[model samples]
Target: MTSTENEAHRRDGADPGHRHLFHVPPADGGRYPESAYLAGNSLGLQPRATRTELLADLDAWSRLGVEGHLEAERPWLPYHGLLTAPAARLVGARPSETVVMNSLTVNLHLLMVSFYRPAGERTRIVIEDTAFPSDSYAVRSQARFHGLDPDTTVVRLRPRDGEENLRTEDVTAFLAAEGHTVALVLLGGVNYLTGELLDIPAITAAGRAAGAVVGWDLAHAAGNVPLSLHDWDVDFAAWCSYKYLNSGPGALAGVFVHERHHGDTGLPRFEGWWSTAADTRFEMTPVSRPPATVEAWQISNPPIFAMGPVRTSLELFDAVGMPALRDRSLRLTGYLERLLDEVTADRPLTVVTPRDPARRGCQLSVRIGTGNANELTKRLRHEHGVIADAREPDIVRFAPVPLYSTYHDCWRVADALAATVEATS
Candidate 1:
């Protein structure tokens, strides 16, 4: 009923004093204690719910002792099972195709033992040039275990000149052109240094077309982005729960194996009592038939107390769906980037993270030109209390996790970064 101009002028949810849902600006009009907690890519902030969950487990342990395996609210016997469905939902996998068990690297080595079977000329491994160091080491060791030389067998995918991010085409093209020789395509779901998210669906299809197995290291991407491991037809993937999932330091990690891989009762694995068939496990039989889902990868009984915090973190995701969480993340990171530009004003710094939202999660990898980044990170901590991470030579990585981080936190990072840069210069 109103004129177009009038209708356009009226904002739908305008309240001049509106604040972002998570915004709690520094109270002292100075840096708050939590401002320096931008290391969620390395480790997440502990949720307030973690303590209660831990106490519940402790109480169960004390009350039931040996019977706690079947007695508690979350029985120790099936506690890891309870995590599978939720973790599967988090990573875009079927409940029957995922499990939370071993740590990240351990899962990688074990998965390789089962999936990285190289034969004849198809014994080469494809990896990114800037792949995480631990992954490089593991892949190399895997090749050596199979009588292949890593220097000759490992194929590194590289970005074009003057580029810090990898192109999906280059990755796929490498797979296609060199398809005949490639055995496994192992790369991070999100490149850890640049925070560039690869096109998983496309990459997986390409790798499969090339007759290679595709696996992802989701250490940085797992809870930060929406994944569809089952839909994409990935062979396997591994991720630590300590980062975006906020499951405390070095917590139980998750693994996903395609449903097709489960029934192969004869595939190799580094097995132990926990991985033996549950019905016959206590019998201590020499036979080990992995559980139908990915839990068959477990080599030892889970550390119940360590899993408590992870259980609490996954509950937070259930409360706040990934869609809404990612919505807030995009806005918060953009706000930080804009404020950085305002303060820096054409400074030498350049952001390596993709400008596209689809290509990044909650991280902004700022390339501080030609100077010492480590010292800058240290100064930010001691002087300003703005905790961000410094990558080797010159980049400082900042990740503001949506669950606990806020617009004001992003604002503070920008403000502090500008001050730090100007002072350092």
Candidate 2:
């Protein structure tokens, strides 16, 4: 490793170079030791601890059966709470303000049920033009459910005519102008496509100042970046554990609701058996009394199997801590960007993600104007054992996670990208 790389590895006090902690699969039909797995922004690498953790839950189910809810080793009844504090720490929330619950989009809908209250002329919902399709679908459907037209009730924010990413000033200005009309302001904490880390605190404050309830889809930001949802005074936020959290594919997600909103039983929500206070949950009271915490938004009991990987992953995160991980992530992604610049010097490649570390996470999205980005991505995987995700048109996203990715991995990706572009060009 180079001196810079050695310094980065030592500074974090954790070496991702020893890849044994992750279950990296062989690429090119077992010809390579492992594929350069640079797609953590989509799905994180599975931790080695997952199997053991999952088996423990499975064993409890097998041995204790119905009694596992009370008598199991981990006690399935309060299993979700085990993740609450660690998850809250990850997002800079209090334990009571956060809860590990349903899927990402599901939590978004749940939070919106409580926060998206439209009345009078303030019937609009504000979101980004490049929001994940699922978020747009949720907003449009919510608008329709409220007897409003999305075309009129939805305000989509976009960059200036020639710019690729939205500026903090632009977002604040738009919220200032249309805040009165907007009932809810929801956006991605990080742009999934461009890899741009939005200014969450600034946007949240602006939205709130405009008298709009602000929330965020933290699917890409939750574990990848440092967030202070509580400190930022965000109304609500949701994220999945399958990304930088290192949980398995389709693992359970999380939600955050500020403590101020928790006591307001006047807020409308869709409650369930699990939403009631845990102590009185099984009493089956005639009246529905929901807890004054984020758990009140949960629709069902915890999914132990789905949450197993989360428990294992969060333990690792707590041990390493987000501050150190983020520090390493900035340097690692910066190194990747520098390598790409060197290799693609002669090519008409554009790094679509923000160049500044403050505006990006671990991902560096490149637009390979070569007209065959998908082809190049496929060639990189099949031929050179480099794995990166290809978006529509010509964008390829590479996320070098700080947990299980190494500097050598970035070098391999740059070399493979250079070779693939040369071959395709």
Q: RMSD in Å for candidate 2, one decimal?
A: 2.5
TM-score, every prediction: 0.91, 0.95
Q: How accurate is candidate 2 locally (lDDT)?
A: 0.87
Best by lDDT: 2
Error of 2 at 148 (Å): 0.8
Question: How good is model 2 by TM-score?
Answer: 0.95
What are the C-alpha RMSDs, in order, of all predicted structures?
5.1, 2.5
Q: Pick the candidate with the highest TM-score.
A: 2
lDDT of 1 at 204: 94
> Candidate 1 overall Cα lDDT vs. reference?
0.81
